[model samples]
Target: MGAQKIVRQEADTVGENPLRLEKEKAEQIVDALNTDLADAYVLYHQLHKHHWNVEGAEHLGVHEFLEEAYEDVEDAADELAERVQTLGGVPHASMTALSEAATVEPEDEDVYDVRTSFENDIEMYGSIMESYREHIELAENLGDHATGELLRQHLLELEEHVHVMDHYLEDDSLVQS
Candidate 1:
């Protein structure tokens, strides 16, 4: 067979071509996913650290809730990384990458207060929700229905988390003297 035929055979064997426009679309989705994953991971670590070290009246509630959120976000990060790898791209994990990509600001050393923590979490979750929604849109545009469906489920969960955190933060404001 000719060289072009061999290239076509290889491409067929490996499934979709990764260098095409669709792969670029996949990469675009992965870029947003990568940023969100980094942000979520950073927030997850910060929440876990705060959970261990928080010293206040709502310590247990805050710690336990934050841990739950952390677990959810960690799972999401794993799935997104796998998706990135599936698209023949690397998912970033370094702290430097997280710092640069994070839409959620770094956890303040002085932000140990329950209300502050909740506010930070609400902001982070909101950013994540937006990214997930955008990923869903991109998946739809690319005709990747399976990815779109998966992203919808993840977006729903993120929305719920954001709503719950928002409620908690609002309640915290109300409870303040």
Candidate 2:
């Protein structure tokens, strides 16, 4: 052998590390977090798309609100991915992976109406909240306090977004009768 090449595998790739939690428990938590991360990413992109495409008298307001909402969601996605890495797991890297793992479905590109976008957002937020609660409980049960806390924080932010969207839906001015 004229030259020998050494291939290096990362902790995540090899699934070998000095994590204190049981490997199974860590994997479980990571899997849950990854799913949540996927949902967050999908929601973020949906919100951004709606922000740009939203049309009606309240278009400016809805666009600004969606911008803020998506920003928060982006932060949540980053934190979730970081938590997965901290737990000695690899976060999903591809759009296909994120889309496949996500529980929240994206709206069709043709659906650009403001009212429909808000309605879809509210529904998506509800689904994400449910997933967050489930993951939080699972993390707690598994003694992954860090993951639990991270999800709890995301839950609060998502709840705020839902509240805002609900208020918008309640606005009579926006409703067509």
Candidate 3:
């Protein structure tokens, strides 16, 4: 057999949750979370790309920071996937599903200077952070306090990285042109 199907939980459908949330509300939370999960993966890949291509002054520091940022995004995506499962929903696993669900736009495949890369990263992080804020409100509104709290924690780190990058982009840097 190629692969016999069993225990199917379609991505669009919600099953029973131990927390006893209403199916409709649970579905809303699932949709928001899946978007967050997709955005995190996109951020992870873009940051990884920047990490690989970074150059110029402070290249080592920028490269290392990109790795750290992407790792954090990867961890966040894992948590989001698990949270979807906990809420009795199937997480978006296919690249197409994720891309469809994602609200954040990633940079194109072309490599750029570290400044341009950080600028793009900052933009991506801003969108994800904004979505997290909205999702946190949605989760709390639906009495999914745990999910809200999870995104809140992630937001703090996201802000911290943006702050550091803002400093990096300050005009006091050693660039001649």
Candidate 4:
């Protein structure tokens, strides 16, 4: 992939209003939230890609699962971006910015077995959960309750996703020998 040029937006002229949280703390939380948002966006696209291309013994099942997963991820990404705006920081809207900020790396668009796809998804969820945990801890330490709560919800959802993926792997019936 070619290197993407990142264009930074000019600072907004709106004077700081009266949010109780310290500006520095809020900025830190915003930074973390933006990263999470970018990761979510990338993951969303990955899930969508898999949804369209997945084929195997579990074709329909994996297809449907990816549909639901990507939808949920899209919603979560929107929420993360909105949270960044609420904290008075510009959300990373450009693909370049998102790619730069994201913790999730895009996978090669190669045909893979259902098992491999599931394994890749599981790994991605693990990385996302790790980032969520770190952000949650940082938010709580900064006394940014709202951001912490938002991240906690995401963390729970990601944990459930990981569990479901693990279950898929554990169930031998889901895999064709």
TM-score of model 1 (CA atoms): 0.76
The alpha-carbon RMSD values of the candidates against the true structure, listed in the order shown, are 7.5, 3.4, 1.4, 5.5
Query: Which candidate number has the best lDDT?
Result: 3
lDDT of 4 by residue, 37-137 (tens): 98999888888988988876878877898898899898899999888777777888898889898988878988677678778888888899999999999
Query: What's the TM-score of every candidate structure?
Result: 0.76, 0.88, 0.94, 0.88
Stretches > 4 Å off in candidate 2 = 1-19, 174-177
Candidates sorted by lDDT, best first: 3, 2, 4, 1
**Residue 123 Cα positional deviation in candidate 4, in Å, after optimal superposition:** 1.1
What's model 3's overall lDDT? Answer: 0.91
10 residues in a row with least lDDT, candidate 1: 6-15
Q: For each candidate, what is the lDDT?
A: 0.69, 0.85, 0.91, 0.82
TM-score of 3: 0.94
lDDT of 2 by residue, 1-177 (tens): 578867553423325436588878888888898899999998998999998888777778888999999999999999998888878788887988888888889888786567688899898999999999999999999988878888998899999988988888875674465
lDDT for 153 (candidate 4): 89
Supply candidate 1's per-residue lDDT for 47. Answer: 69
Flag clash pairs in model 3.
Answer: none
